[model samples]
Target: MANDLSLNKEQILDAAEQALKRYGPDKTSVVDVARALQVSHGTLYRHFASKAALREAVTERWLRRSIAEPLAQATGLPQGGSAAERLRLWLDTLIAAKRAHAAEDPELFAMYAAVTMEAAEMIDAHIDGLILQMASIIEDGITAGELRPGRPETIARAIFIATSRFHHPAHAREWNAERTDRDYDSVWELILAGLALPTA
Candidate 1:
């Protein structure tokens, strides 16, 4: 149908994301997105029932891009490395993503907050999966004697929360803004110290 050809769901969602990125959730409107995509408001509504629905979709898309896909990619990496090494790489990747997004689009941080509060369960599930992945790496490290013996899931959950909060721009504005190589090195040292086996 010509109507379907006029505005696909992907385009509408993409436009919503761009709008959120540019103006944040509070300022972004369905009409604005429609205008940005050069489509009538009706076209957007045809795909999304309301502005809130569009926002939810946009938030979901953002999370998938920032968190889900990265975790999935990390899963496929060869599993020969020590758990500490894998965890370090994963944390570094996560922190870098937060910092890059913060510097690239401040509004995205705002949008993240807005959507997170609105869709806590969905966001929590995604985070839980990441924690499980981290736990798996920790267990691997323990088996290799690279890390101290302990419950991997508990440790992973603690590390995930601690690292996430520390890197979260919403909570640690100063740290995120001032993150440098030295900062990253310090974080890695702390994480390794907590999990690594003592040197002889």
Candidate 2:
């Protein structure tokens, strides 16, 4: 119930997110968002070119939450913290965030999963963005002399793929299994050991 004249793009996106949460992505539409804001469809379209564009924007916003803040912390690891610690924090935080989303509302999470699949371009960009963030952390580790010499981009992608189960939407349901935390610990330890330089 937002006033049309005062509405902005963020307001539209917020209303759209709520609509998607309530009616789901498949049933939700630009018109619904407009109705929520008490605006005309034309007004909404003035902000977003099309429904698909709006959906992509919303998806980007959702994906950004998992990357933007966490990447900053991962790249800015505290003094005395190893790259392994930063990597572990990144992976663990992502898993927890995904789990929190599901716990908050399984239906909404499911809707997003579906929307994600439909928005292929946005998903590709999201994955690329994650890889770039991971690479930056890996490069930082190398630069700090905490990790062995190697191609950071390759290592970053390997790490991302290695920890896929913890954050991938397809594996969302299995994240809470009793052994999942144990599994993550084992994987993290293995990666840390592999990446660390051998002592003389």
Candidate 3:
């Protein structure tokens, strides 16, 4: 294989994702990724310590791109807008992102699911990021007098737990159900009742 000096971590990850999609995570190897990149396998080792390391990187990257990044953007609510509205937008962006990722590339999604299960730290970190996004929205709501005053982090954690089925990857199968949106709306309404102020 050529000693491709320009091979960076991003290139390795892109190749690794292709390899995972083509061969599945269990069968893919660092050698396979290097082969795909036309580089020496040892070159990849410089970027990722091992095959497992490469997979973990791929999973983390996917989580950020497909989930966290979009939700991060959703936290930017307009001035004087309802925090409840911003919160709903956050959920909608999250749900749409996951559903589209899963539907458009079932193979990649399955690979992501398998690897993520083995990466608890990665999952926890990802959830923490999402929880922070939730807290930001809740904090804005409370500041605007649209929501009850409470610890935003505490309320965000509770809301995240309450709405897990709507966004969590483990519950992906139920996402396509006819009653899924209605079910989520009912859950959201209950959460809003607890958090939002009633208008006279």
Candidate 4:
């Protein structure tokens, strides 16, 4: 008996993920998801209108829980620390999230590469959210006199672009390379110098 009287989108997404794992992205159908949840197709349709919509929801959910949420939690920014330290924590949190996702869900991580391209709009929003987060820290840095006065968004975007290799899914293969952390540290050194924040 399907006790889905209180079923929600999150529950639908959870079922969809299981279907995806079994069928991969290309083969996973709405029916598969509905079947997994032991619900009718109309029930699933109420949450996600189409397979594409379902994919986008899955992508958005992954980006939120895996990346954006963690970074926000790691640094509730615009706080008391020098911006450099906050940025370090923020960037480290990002790198750690990416690495963990790749390692923990290698199959999904690989499959997501294809879905992400199709979900460009969602990806853009996610990137924008992360940049805004960094911008908050940068704004605080300027106020604290640890960084040069400038547009926070522009600076945040630049830093994000510069450090994309660490967090970008395309670089998952290189994440485990022996030189990865050393390379990341080197980039951090350059970024720190540019920020004019005191390093200890």
TM-score of each: 0.78, 0.86, 0.91, 0.89
Candidate 3, which ten residues in sequence have the lowest lDDT sum? 73-82
Q: What tens-digit string does per-residue lDDT give for candidate 4 at 21-137?
A: 778888989988988888888888888889988888887899898888878876694466678889998998888877888898787787666666777878889999999999999
Report the C-alpha lDDT of model 1 over 93-122, residue by residue, as the tens digit. 777777777677777676676667787787
Clashing pairs in 3: none
lDDT digits (tens) for residues 148-193 of candidate 3: 9999999999998898897777788888999999999999999999
Worst 10 residues of 2 by lDDT: 71-80
Candidate 2: tens digits of C-alpha lDDT, residues 74-185: 6566546676777777777777878888899787677667767788887877777777777877888889888898998899888888888788788888977999988988
Better of 3 and 4 by lDDT: 4
Assess each prediction's global lDDT (C-alpha) against the native.
Answer: 0.76, 0.80, 0.84, 0.85
Q: Give the Å error, residue 133, model 3.
A: 1.3
Stretches > 4 Å off in candidate 1: 5-8, 22-24, 35-43, 78-80, 176-188, 198-200
Error of 1 at 5 (Å): 7.5
Top TM-score hit: 3
